[model samples]
Target: MLARSIIFLLLSLSACPLFAQQKYIMTVRGKVKADAIGRTLAHEHIVTNFIGAATVVDVPGDDSVVIAKILPQLLRLKGQGINTLIECTPNFIGRNPALLKKLSELSDLNIVTNTGLYSAVDKKYLPPYAFTENAAGIASRWEAEWTNGIGGTGIRPGFIKLGAGSSALDSIEAKMLAAAILLSRKSLLPIAIHSGSGQAAISAFEQLKKSNWKPEKLIWVHAQNGTDEERAMLANEGVWISLDGVSEKSWEQYAGMILFLKKRNMLHRLLISHDDGWAVLENGSYNKLDLFENGNSIPYSTLFTKLLPALKKAGVTESEIDMILRNNTGDCFSF
Candidate 1:
């Protein structure tokens, strides 16, 4: 009788799911596959710091205070038919388990958070934990968030994120990338990279591939900022390209990039996002806008309300748009 009881307990423990607290049999292991049929914004920041970047802006306040002020703005986004938000802030300003759970409870939108490092440009501002921490150290932190919970909630991050700036890649970045790649392979998680400039995407990809990462599980964001050759090479490598920076007046660079890629019939592997999250005050109040607007506020609806149609009118097929905006994102970020 004792032996039988022990065996039953062991079996029950083994059968318990990884993210058992989330009420799902399987943890979100790889690209999430879903209908994603409604109006979905591929990339948008529900909450991030305007001053978190290395460069300081006029916005004066504590980081926590700034983040606190941004909650209502995200709520506004939910009302705009934006069903999803991929909050790609790096670990220092990201992986807020309590904040994410709060947002999830507040809105019907799906808020998929990330865990990883930022570009070399942010090296100056990175917390001591990430810099002093080794690859295993970082991985352990990430695993804690995944298995246990983030910021005291059982809400684990839905994906991983990496960033590259104008400067060349560094050892720290490489180490973070390697760690994220290894964790991704072990856990079958999807990764999102910020290729703002330089050969960061290619460099990160080289590292991930070296670690035998599945190309399908990789998402190289800000591809709209890369050159045509770079974009084509990445597409041919079977990585998903995110063109979420499209803006008519502001992001002409990305606009041209997307149009060119579409012309080359390389739009299927693409995922569209606006990457917007800025608070701009209008008459006696404020509003939120795109990330790259340079203080010029463009409503968050510009993507679905404007840029997507422009892509269609510019000879980009409806099928391609649908795949990028809805299909590819859901598929790549699913486990």
Candidate 2:
């Protein structure tokens, strides 16, 4: 047993980067640590609006109203011991480095931001240039966001995000995905994909594999909505499965899948996130807007009060939760 353990350790060490180091912009008191990883909501739009890049002329609100709306939620998340959040807001709307920096300073929450283009449900809503933009153009912008920082603040993004159309991967979206993979490989950044229902997760992975991208470098988000067989396949490839439940109807629906992965010793690569945001008021307005008006109301408190407790009740150990939240998240963006 001792010899076997030693061999395993050696192999693990060999797989890790030779000059492994903990790289992060800011750190919190109790939560941020190089070794910390558990219960990370691998899929969450920390600050985002439903309309996204589209003009929301109907939404009655300015920047201040949005920030005020989401402040409480950020405060709540801070209190919840949710060490880190991989905010999957792409460059155009969701990338707010200054505001994120302020939130980290004020809330002490580790907000890992992402870079890349968004794949909207409706192509008609996308930017006029987005449809005609070639893969190289998208990739150049993505690379700029990572190296030079979004909008020239020099605040580098932590990960790359790619999404398909609400229904399937369209030609333009596929080009964007391929471009994202190319840029991510060059920058050594991990890629996260929005796999909306059906075999989206599997298809995305298949595309990545075809591009010769390693599975470990990709995170297939919304695994909770995927079929059992698809989830199992992702687990086998050592891909991270984000079993987001916040927006999903029932968190319990994912419990079985979580248990299955755990039983199969695949829990290390799993993540759980709420994917929820500010409440939609009766008048059809969203509260909790951030600096860029892309904010949500699902504060840290929600994670601690509702989400964490629910998972605990579902038999998730604190250590395991830490792995999902802290360790796995850190690993995802180690590049």
**Top lDDT: which candidate number?**
2
- Give me the runs in candidate 1 sitting further than 4 Å from their true place: 1-33, 36-39, 50-81, 251-253, 279-296
lDDT of 2: 0.65
TM-score of every model versus the real structure: 0.75, 0.78
RMSD of 1: 7.5
Off by over 4 Å in 2: 1-39, 52-67, 166-168, 247-249, 279-303, 306-314
> What is candidate 1's lDDT per residue for 1-335, written digit by digit as tens?
99999999888877787523321111112223355434456666644444443443332223344345666666677776565677665555423445555555555556677766774566753666777878888888887776665655566777777766754557877877777876787666677877765277787777777778788777878776677888878887888888776554545565567888777777777777777665333211123422445322554656656676666777777778767766666666666
* Model 1 clashing residue pairs (backbone): 29-188, 30-334, 30-335, 31-332, 31-334, 32-333, 32-334, 244-273, 280-287, 281-286
Per residue, candidate 2 scores C-alpha lDDT tens digits across 258-307 of 77887777888887776664422322344433332212233333445455
